[model samples]
Target: MDPTIRNAKLQDIEFVLSGIREIFKIENDIFVYSEKKKLARNAIRDKHIRVAMRGDKPIGFSWFKIGDLTPFGLDYGKWSRKYCWISFVYVLKNYRNKGIGSLLYEDIMRICKRKKVKQIMLDVFTVNKKSARFHERIGFKPLLSIFTMRAR
Candidate 1:
């Protein structure tokens, strides 16, 4: 079945937050929950988040914003005044390879194109081979690598 892509609503807060937590696999501290809640709430309220529903349940979602390049985004291999930054995208584990993720990604691309965005950017950890492969299949190129050094 085709998925219904639409702006997220307040009711989607839990689903959105859970997606973030699961994808990031970060510690579920009170501060983390609060921050996720705030961000999810704001994104939905601003209509910056989209949800793909298959028969009334959300199969996946994507949150995006237009802005200057960041470490988490591609550099387009050239200068651009602005870019479409995809903050997060998540597909339910059971929904893998069902085309739902592509639909959501395509919708985001359409929006960015309509807005004349020069490039679309997002990032996945180097260890996430699955995500990297999926992105490559969808036409994303690596612009840079992010490294972390602990100052102990």
Candidate 2:
């Protein structure tokens, strides 16, 4: 059976943390579980987060935020009135390739449409070609390239 998508709740913290851990592992980034937990709590409370559930188990999730571009000095009226930035979309390894991620995105799309969001944006790591391709397949175009240099 397919997973169902629903808004995340504080009760889902552990599952969300596990998903964040997996993402950090994939990115080779370091994180403290306690700190990540705090961020996850805040995300659940402040941002728009949705989880994919198969029965009672959480299998995947997507995180995003809605805001206006006017804060960034782009006061273009309706064009900049509303937008969405997808921060993360992840599925458990075992549940991947089964359309759970797409289902989560479909939920986000429905929310955006209801809110009249003008644009949706997201950042994919250069090393994660799979995610970049998925975004492209979903009609997301590259708007800018970001580069970073690590110092020793």
Candidate 3:
């Protein structure tokens, strides 16, 4: 539990993107996907992005933005207050199952509270059972089903 969690800065963009890439490679195997650089440069560039670091090395990261839309796992009509949308959350494979994800989640929730947000929302792929469990454990219950119809 020696990891330090803090708000990321512009100088930390590369490190954050690199850490996310590592997570994607291990968890999703989407080696060619990387829009974090542009996303980082766009809106979140001014907002806060939190990163977890063990000594000088980063092991996980989470980015959020304030919004009104309820993500896939939330009932938007039930709650009308503004929400905090977690854009991206990832932990390095080597650091998984070590409580780092929970730590980061708590930290982000604290931030949300400080910001006076009414709720926190996020989306996980319907097929990722592991991820769904993680979110459930953290008290994010499923609220909506997204159906995509493929053209034959």
Candidate 4:
């Protein structure tokens, strides 16, 4: 059976955040609930969240937004238009590898196409290799690599 994709409404914030939190927990990333609450609010406000539902339950979601290029980062002159940044994409563990992520991603791609966004980008922590591979499989090429060094 195929999962249904829909734009997230204000009432769907909690479920979307829950799916995101599960992915973060599995990746061992520290996230403040308060901050997530704020992000959910903003994503909903901007209509940037997409949820994948299996029946009445949400099985995955993608939080995305338009982002600008900073001079310190990529060379904006090389790129023709602003990029759509996929802030997060999370699929329930039990529903993973079932093409659910692909379904959500296609929705984002359609949005980008309609908006004339020339590029789509996302960052995956090195710890989450599965996500990296998934993104690659979906035709997202490597553009940048960011590293973090914790204070000892």
Give candidates' CA RMSD values in order.
3.1, 3.1, 3.3, 2.5
Q: Which lDDT value does model 2 have at 146?
A: 65
Considering lDDT, which of the candidate structures 3 and 4 is the better prediction for this target? 4
| Candidate 2 global TM-score | 0.86
Instruction: Report, for every candidate in turn, its global Cα lDDT versus the true structure.
Output: 0.83, 0.83, 0.77, 0.83
Q: Global lDDT for candidate 1?
A: 0.83
Candidate 3 global TM-score: 0.80
Tens-digit lDDT track for model 4 on 1-152?
89888888888888887877777886788868889999899888888888888999888898988766643466544554688878889888899888998999898989888988888877777788898899889898877776778999
lDDT of 1 by residue, 1-152 (tens): 68899999999889888888887773222438898899889888888999999888987899998866554454446645678878788898899898888899899988988888887877778767888899999899997787878799
CA displacement after TM-score superposition, residue 74 of candidate 2 (Å)? 12
RMSD of 2: 3.1
TM-scores for all candidates: the values are 0.86, 0.86, 0.80, 0.86
What is the Å distance of residue 117 in model 2 from its true position? 0.4
lDDT of 2 by residue, 1-152 (tens): 88888889999989888887877777778868999888788888885788898999988999888886543453334554578878789998898888788888889999999998878877788878888988898789887676889998
What is the Cα-based TM-score of model 1? Answer: 0.86
As for candidate 1, its clashing pairs are none
**Candidate with better lDDT, 1 vs 3:** 1
- lDDT of model 4, residue 30: 83
Error of 3 at 140 (Å): 0.7
lDDT of 3 by residue, 5-118 (tens): 987767667777876676565456574435668777564456658888898887788888876665554565766687888867878878898899899999988888888997
Residue pairs whose backbone atoms clash in candidate 3: none
